[model samples]
Target: MADKLKVALAIALVVAGVVGFYLLSEQALVLRVLSVLAGVAAAAAVASQSESGRRFVGFARESVTETKKVVWPSRKETVQTTGMVFAFVVVMAIFLWLTDKSLEWVMYDLILGWK
Candidate 1:
């Protein structure tokens, strides 16, 4: 029951923020932005009180930590790999083109006797 209330309150907070932003359009731009941000933060806080929300926050934190630990490839390594891939593709394309032309010549000039 309490979780449901928290979820409802969070939704209400976010909706109210959107509505307030439009309502305060005539006000200073900074004030309108701050008001909306405050409402969003409040909604997030309310949401964090729920079990699922807490779990989501924990998962996000863990994901960020794991991402930070990842070792990305250096620029030089990336360039070298890309160059190798392009070289292989060009070689394969030439080989296939030669094979196609050879087959065409054999089929038309040698076997068919048609110009």
Candidate 2:
């Protein structure tokens, strides 16, 4: 029951923040933005008390930790792999073009005599 109420309040806070932004449009842009941010912080604080929100926060923290443990490829390895991929693509393009031209020649020049 308490968790449900906290979640609802969090949603309400976010909605109120959006409304406030529109309502305070006549105010200075910086002040209005700060107010909206404060509302978002409040909403986050309220939401963090809920079970689902806590789980999400834990998941985000774990994701960051796992990201840090990743072994990224070095710059040289990345560049070399990229160059090889480009070379293979060019070779395939040339091969496909030759095959297409050969088929066109056989169909039009030799078989149909349309040339």
Query: Whose TM-score is greatest here?
Result: 2
Q: What TM-score would you give candidate 1 relative to the actual structure?
A: 0.70
Residue 9, candidate 1: how far off, in angstroms? 0.7
Clashes of 1: 0
> Which regions of candidate 2 fall more than 4 Å away from where they truly are?
110-112
Q: Tell how far residue 81 is off in model 1, in angstroms.
A: 3.3
Q: After superposition, how far is residue 46 of candidate 1 from its true place, in Å?
A: 0.7
Q: What local lDDT score does residue 23 receive in model 1, on the 0 to 100 scale?
A: 94
True-structure RMSD for candidate 2: 2.0
lDDT of 1: 0.94
TM-score per model over all chains: 0.70, 0.81
Instruction: Give the clash total for candidate 2.
Output: 0
The C-alpha lDDT values of all candidates are 0.94, 0.94
